[model samples]
Target: MLSILIPTYNYVCVKLVTDLQQQAERLECPYEILVADDASEDAFKRENRKINGIPNCKYIELQENVGRSRIRNILGRLARYDFFLFLDCDGGIVNADFLARYKALLDKADVICGSILHPSKQPSPDVSLRYTYEKHAEHKFTAQKRMQHPYAMFRSFNFLISRSAFQACPFDETIRNYGYEDVMMGLALGRANVSVLHIDNPLMNEDIEKNAVFLHKTEESLRTLYVHRQKLGYCTGVLRLYGILQRMHLIFSILLLYRLLRRVIRRNLLGKRPSLGLFAFYKIGYYCNLAKERK
Candidate 1:
């Protein structure tokens, strides 16, 4: 038996339900879908009731917004099966055989990870650009490298793990929020000597609108970095190099801002609008902050 666990917030419940329905239809074996919602203030509870009629789907809404790590940990503990598949509410099945593929290799590895891909088009330019960049980064890994690479810590969008492994090392709720919980979990699994198998299956990640409250999210990322730096002693040389790159990226960003303004004034650009590439700046800033915390 397999338990498909999803963590949801706010209005994303609609897509979450739809994706689960698709997964249920496509899966060849029996599975239960569990949605652990973080007490969205929006109409998700009402919406969830309307969709409760869907088969093999269970929804649990909390009284408040507990962070993702805690929510997932709760789901893991509550899951009925010995094996669990963790899927982001926004992720959907790419092929009919995705569940079967994971099932085939369950005995050999403690964790099996699937690849994440983006849809062909997106509703918003900002969202489209972000998806395009992330898709590029995710696909850069080969199956072997993805399975064993040290950098695999950077990804956690799609994966499967045995309930026993999860029981041995549940997500670090101390990390809180969204950033490094996945990395910490992967590291814990490594320490336990659990084999991580990367499946070469493409999974679709639906693009969503970027939140206007971006700075708040960045702060969460920075907090996560601080915790990671404390837990894992990253090398000093790498730390110094990270600071230098961060400053360089910030300088280049100011220059790029001016260039972007000039182009916008010259003519109306069609197709996808260019992003300021602030994600790189955020990453560099995170590394720099981590380095500072270490000092």
Candidate 2:
């Protein structure tokens, strides 16, 4: 009794749903795969509508685009099984036993984060920022490491949760943008004292945005965090650093350095070989810039 819930936007997921359908069929268990398209483009809508033809699968297209948080909530409410497996539409079912792995652990904990993996084969430099970031940080996401700080490491890309747990701590609907929703969920789940079990079941991240696009999304996520920092009641590295700088009266110095190096950092990040160190500074500076704008 598992519900495979997927939310899509401007991306075709017939293949994803088909692969999942086959896996569920093998389990010989009662499972339904639901794909909710968040008012994607006409092409994607047409392509994903074919998911309905697959056995034990249904596709629903929304009239209006409900942001990321609401779309997942919509699918959670629509799910008919005791357990819900939330997978991003762009995920590639690399392992045939993905569903089986989750099914084996359904009773182990209140929540299970399957985690995500970038492609083993690196992409071209033109679109490697996200890849580099993910690859370099891959060690940090291992089951052993994640278990140390389960709540902070919880990711939404591929995770399993009981329907009861989901209903108790749903994604914060107020977050209409792209960042920290997972962190917020992790916090809420922690507050609810929901048991989380980290496992090695990973889905390959099939879609990696180009460097510039990812940079923009990164900024949007930072803005989201900054906007809702109070509600989050958590301190990310960026937030912690920001607070320290503010308290030490060093904000102005960092702002000045950031302004001077902004162009250089942008150039490096957009180039073939980007420096992750500079990328880190860019985020701090960008976040500080946002704070300055508000004041």
Candidate 3:
């Protein structure tokens, strides 16, 4: 009845898979779990190889590491069941009835977004950047708010999509990076007129990297976002504001102001318990810097 698909990269997912398997067993339905290793190291390989022996679960180790978007596309293609349940390796089952809630939503919408939740408490100092940002900006996304911006809010984590809808608009494989791929997929689904339903059921996101790693990945995603902005209908929202600034010949002045504040903003973001508002400014400055570099 469902296919639980997870893409792992050097992360141990034994606990996650076990929780999902137990839930599926309780449902008493036909289900398969697929875990693909994206060419991780020996330690992860040894641990994840255990999945190979599990019943109704397949473990595939690719010789080469395909980036985030392609790996998910690969998982979708490998899924045998009609409904595909995509979960990140770092995510944990928030509740025992997680799968059941998703199953109930199957017939109601073409795509389902089981929301994301962070731990109520903060993680360690080293890995707090992702936690802080998610807690402030993303983790609290309400079902009502998501409806207003379905395309922008439709993240790729803990969601169920039928085979027909997935094959209609698979993730863009050209995006071979860490960030904004979910945004890209959401945009595609919206353009195709696919209906998305949001619910309170959430996955506990456990993967938290150091501040430095988070910033690097954020910059990488910004690069990808700038490159794809045109394809994503660039002349909307903030882009419209930017276009107006460009027309009035104020972009250079704005860029210079951003450049002046970039270092101060970066200092705040890289520090302990950083401000997400400052980080947003940092990202805007970084993306604007990239945009200026290209011209």
Which predicted model would earn the best lDDT?
Answer: 2
Where model 2 places Cα greater than 4 Å from the true spot, the runs are: none
- After superposing candidate 3 on the true structure, give the runs of residues whose Cα lies further than 4 Å from its correct spot: 138-140, 235-241
lDDT of 1 by residue, 1-295 (tens): 7898888776555655666567667766678888887887656677765555778888888888879789999999889988888888777667776777887887978788877777766657645445545656655665766755733343467788898888987888886666767777777787887777877776677744453234346456666666566564452323345546566665355335534553442222222543434444444544454444566
Residue 273's lDDT within candidate 2 is 80
How would you encode candidate 2's per-residue C-alpha lDDT over 92-202 as one tens digit per residue? Answer: 988889999999888899999997889887778868788888888899899989999988888899999999999999999999998999999999998899999999998
> Residue 110 deviation, candidate 1, in Å?
1.1
Error of 1 at 84 (Å): 0.5
lDDT of 3 by residue, 1-295 (tens): 7999999998999888888888998888899999999999989989998887777888889899998889999999989899999999999887989999988778998898888888887878876678788777763498888877877888887788999999998999888877778877888898899989887888988888888889998888778877778776662334555667679988787788788887787777778878877776576667667888997
What is the full ranking by TM-score, best candidate first?
2, 3, 1
lDDT accuracy of residue 133 in candidate 3: 82
What candidate 1 gets wrong by more than 4 Å, as runs, is: 14-30, 211-216, 235-240, 243-279, 285-295
Count of backbone clashes for each model? 0, 0, 1
For each candidate, give its TM-score against the true structure. 0.77, 0.98, 0.93
lDDT head-to-head 1 vs 2, winner: 2
* lDDT assessment of candidate 1: 0.67
| Candidate 3 TM-score over all chains jointly | 0.93
Computed on alpha carbons, the lDDT of every model, listed in order, comes to: 0.67, 0.91, 0.84
TM-score of 1: 0.77
